[model samples]
Target: MFTREWLRAVVVVMFTLAPMSVGAEVPWQFADNTRYMAMGDSLVAGYGAIPATQGYAYLLYKEGVFDKIPNTLLSNVGLIGATSQDVLDKQVPLAIDPFVPTVITLTVGGNDLASILTGADPATVLGNFQANLTNIFFQLRTALPEAKIYVSNLYDIPEIPMATEIVLLFNGIVEGVASGFQVPVADVFSAFEGRKGLRLIQRNGADQYEVHPSNAGHRAIAKAFKAVIENN
Candidate 1:
């Protein structure tokens, strides 16, 4: 027969080796009535994805980044060609009023930089972008003090001249503004850096190129958002 002390020691070891509960490991819970709003440009609208449903915003909703599908209601107000000013003027109002989002993801400023391609002064474009982005964040934070907001930085396209440099500047602005409002930034720039087959425009053989993420790229962007949300 085993000694009482030996049996007690065995039980202690078994208890010590037991696995932790799944709930304890997870950082977030599936809270009820989570309203998620996505605001930005073409990427938010899923332009590059064939059906658009494959866009990062949709994927985040479908995959339950913020909460479970049953508990999460997603409203994507990301216009196809929306600039920072457009988002401030159009999307923010909707987010504040009827939607009253508990969670928001914004992706703007790319269209603001497009003005540079048309001979608009880079300094002027960047200044407007910075001001508009600052206002966008300020309004959202002020209006929805309890909501969690995440923003994405721009990715680099190697094909265009000085694209990398310009994108870096834009990402800097994104980071600076986001930091001011205590908003987390999804580092899409790093996700696409030196990566092949992320841009839909690159896959097409035509001389003209459009600056949008492919399906795989959307997935990458979703992953970036998910990472920040989970950590935050």
Candidate 2:
């Protein structure tokens, strides 16, 4: 069994391990035309990946999994340790809206519960995260009226059972919110389930369930978003 504060400890470890320069460089393709804006936490930032650019946003842009509409620009402003509130209060207006992004992808709420999923009143944290998330969606719709908004539901962290439970609840909220706004959800949860080391995590062989992604995992995320984009 992991530590009592296992999930929180893992997240902090990941954040600490992430270098300042990890995600700073953008592929030439992204810099030239950033029609897509990725906003969220470490997952979106690709913290645990060997090269931060191996994260999902870059994969969606670079992975030739499915063809994108020509000239689609993708940019990721996802920050390590960012919570849903951070996205609402800080990252959104400053980074997202001004870009006039044609497509916006969000993956948030997990960090809001960090150590608190085991707390006495976890519902309170979930509620607050939901409110902040709803506001983010509403604001985005208002600011980028014509933009397509896609939300990535929480995916399970295999070593932590409580985290999976949290993923269920958090993803439910994501589904409900997306439904209300008539937005599409990229079910990154299902995509990551059952194949942690192989499909999702960075490690191969016996141990892949820890956290973060391998290059192939990032490509999977890219495909999930691509599916949403194509269907919607």
Candidate 3:
């Protein structure tokens, strides 16, 4: 059996590579009092990293044009350890508290896949992934009809040998759902694959299975938002 320590060590190998920018922009134009809401899982919640609000959602809010012009940027609705179904069931309702968010960001589905990986059942993982994608999008569309939603393409976590195929399967569902919904898909998968020395699993100085982005990875994701906003 692969010891817990051993599993984490192998996962660390996949993230050791560095990231390059695709430069995708945010689709919504910046406006006064423009509200932004981020709803998703640990990556959205800033897992393995303290001060979760310091994650990309807050970072992007800080860099946003509305922040400079007296806009109201609602706090990021990050639900730690939330699965996609959780987002459907929990986060979306909370998003409407302050007002309608003009912009939305989400990074979910990892927990669902991770759950399957832990159980060693790829078939079950794939089915849950497809269901989660449908539920996540359905909830997003239903809850925030006018919000420009950004659903991230799952990052490759082959760094954790226990679940690469599962990750790929989950990502496939995510991509197909994104296409169907007209939601902008941020492709973190393309950025992580084959990149050397990126280190996806870093927690403090050690590594683990929970995949959170480093400063560099967050910058790349932010760039994608910038690109989507500017071009679309």
**Model 2: lDDT of residue 147:** 75
lDDT of 3 by residue, 111-221 (tens): 777676567577776787677777767766787788788878776766578567766777777778887888877777777667654445644554666576776666566
Q: Evaluate all candidate structures by whole-model CA lDDT and list the values in order.
A: 0.82, 0.69, 0.62
Which stretches of model 3 miss by more than 4 angstroms?
A: 1-32, 48-53, 65-69, 200-205, 208-210
Model 1 residue 149 distance off true place after TM-score fit, in angstroms: 0.4
Highest-scoring model, lDDT: 1
Give the total clashing residue pairs for model 1: 0
Worst 10 residues of 2 by lDDT: 1-10
Candidate 1 structure quality by residue, lDDT tens digits, 127-223: 8999999998888888999999999998998898888899998899889989999999999988988898899768758344588888999999999
Point out the higher-scoring one by TM-score: 1 or 2. 1
Clashing pairs in 1: none
Q: Which lDDT value does model 1 have at 178?
A: 90
Measured by TM-score, how close is model 1 to the native structure?
0.85
In candidate 2, which residue ranges exceed 4 Å CA deviation? 1-34, 64-70, 95-97, 117-120, 198-210
lDDT (tens digit, per residue) of candidate 2 on 123-211: 88889988998899898888878777888886677566577777799889989988988889998888877874533434444253345
